[model samples]
Target: MTTEAETLARTVLSVENLSAWYAESKVLHGISFDVREGELLTLIGRNGAGKTTTLRSIMGIVKKRTGSITFNGDQLIGRRIYEIARKGIGYCPEERAIFSSLSVKENLTLPPVLQSGGMGDEELLEAFPNLRSRASSQGTKLSGGEQQMLAIARILRTGSRFLLLDEPSEGLAPVVVKEIGELILRLKARGFTIILVEQNLRFAKRVADRHVVVENGKVVDILSAAQLDSDMERVQSYLGV
Candidate 1:
């Protein structure tokens, strides 16, 4: 766990006036936020409030986006998805898009290693014991928790220092949700900057260092984990939880 002072010193990603579109419909209307190195932050809001679009825009997956996304002091306004990934940003969407046609091991080894220092086979297995046991199992055969684990593990193998995870704990059982929470804390300790999109405010509270509350396609509030505790009522009103 990093102190607030330490987190502020590293500023990793800055999103300024970011607007995005799905065809002609605007989803994110000039939302702005910053992510600090080694910090785990969450974008929390009701469904359709544009949290997913925010992550997609930062990852350069949303093509019709307009804004200045500065990462490590470089502007990422018009970079392609692969270009952004090569620059060390990994995205694990809500769908947990691991290939259903392949074995777990095959899915793990498929993505091109974008940089050095990625987790090797041993490390990946150690972090996720379920995957270790199901190495040869077909992707579709695993449980939802296992699939989410595989999605996260595959990204860790990419050596990407930054990660964008959308709704990782959604539709998960209580025990499995707890496991995901623990894994997120472990990744933060390993020094990965993460921007998470989560609807479960309780789960978000357990894992994130800060929370950015979105409503109607824009940033309505930003609170530290400490601030969130003292101002729970206000934030809950925004989330309608």
Candidate 2:
């Protein structure tokens, strides 16, 4: 049996010396990491540690950025957001960006399907059973978990196999968080490569294969599930958990 670390899958996303800024303020300072095909990797850090900026930079949402972010041998630098999305990478931002005026079904189907294999509305709704019952309700009518599910489902419709998920478990009830975790695992089972940004280490450990530790916009360490287990105390001390 092949292990998660022993898999021969090629590197799906390679990031090297990545840096980005918000106006005059520089955030990421040459952060670097690589994710393999079908692997679930997490960027774990405290608030304002540039985890979200890293995701934005990958999607070309952070305009003033430098360094190489390659997906399947395609360079992501200088690409437009639409171009990136169309290149088979989906991004689910931390804030559930569902339109308040739109119904749940509307929000789920809003993003254009970027490729041939993108999941349809029916498939996504089926995967997120909570969304099925509330399909006709306005975005504001749903709970936090439902909104998060809607955000993730919206991206799946785009047919981007590589996903950059930002804090999918944030501000949710325990049961809801567990549901989200199960959903992520299901997606992983379907062969989607995922890069997750998370503050919840416990949650991250549950779903992630490996973790890249970020501090002040730089990658300080990378830990596997076993390493993270043995070093839990040290990791938590630095994370301020």
Candidate 3:
């Protein structure tokens, strides 16, 4: 039997009737979901299905949105992006926007205040040993996989509880994709809540416990990983994978 405290602590994020628009062009259409603490939830969709927009809206980056978004029991609506981030939310965009000229260490060192107690290098290094080898290398000097690893590693360093990872598996080799999948599971084991947006079905299945499918900017379906696998046709129909 789970205790009341345990049940209460399990919920980390809640999105209720969330909507977004870019200068009168409405994108997301009243999508909603709940992210339980320590669970890896993946938003599976094709391009322009509002996956990235959802992440941005949660981060308060949309500039114009409606409905309720509560993180860790606090109302996220009307909060600034920095304030949202400070409350343990981290957003990794699809572009892998690392400072081209800044070295790995320098990139991680700047914009240092994300969590209350900063994270130690050992924790992130343990997650990705490859990063430690190229710690001194310039951001633009690293390969695609290395850059992706660094992007995530930088987020971890911020001690964020909820990670909005956008397309971490995009444009990486199979081995690197596997490594990222492992990294997601490891992060989940450490009690971090992750909202991963990915088009890679196999990679998403490997880590996501629950699945949310978006179509035409709305959450059309939600299922467990098993349900998604068993009903591949349904997933493929909406995801068009």
Q: After superposition, how far is residue 181 of candidate 2 from its true place, in Å?
A: 0.5
Candidate 3 matches the true fold with a TM-score of 0.93
TM-score, structure 1 vs. true:
0.96
Candidate 3: pairs in clash? none
Q: How much lDDT does candidate 2 score?
A: 0.91
The predicted structure with the larger TM-score, 1 or 3, is: 1
What overall lDDT, based on C-alpha atoms, would model 1 receive against the true structure? 0.91
Tell me the TM-score of each prediction against the true structure: 0.96, 0.96, 0.93
Best by lDDT: 2
* True lDDT of residue 212, candidate 2: 93
Please give, for residues 1-241, the per-residue lDDT of candidate 1 as tens digits: 3475865577899999999999999998899988888889999999999999898888888899887899999888798888999899999999999898999999888878889988987888888889988999999799999999999999999899899999999899999999999999999998888999999999999999899999989999999898898899999999997
Candidate 2: deviation at residue 107, Å?
1.0
lDDT per residue (tens digit) for residues 89-203 in model 2: 9999998888998999899888998798999878887888889999999987899999998899999998899999999999999999999999999999999999999999889
lDDT of model 3 at residue 35?
89
Clashes of each: 0, 1, 0
Off by over 4 Å in 1: 1-4
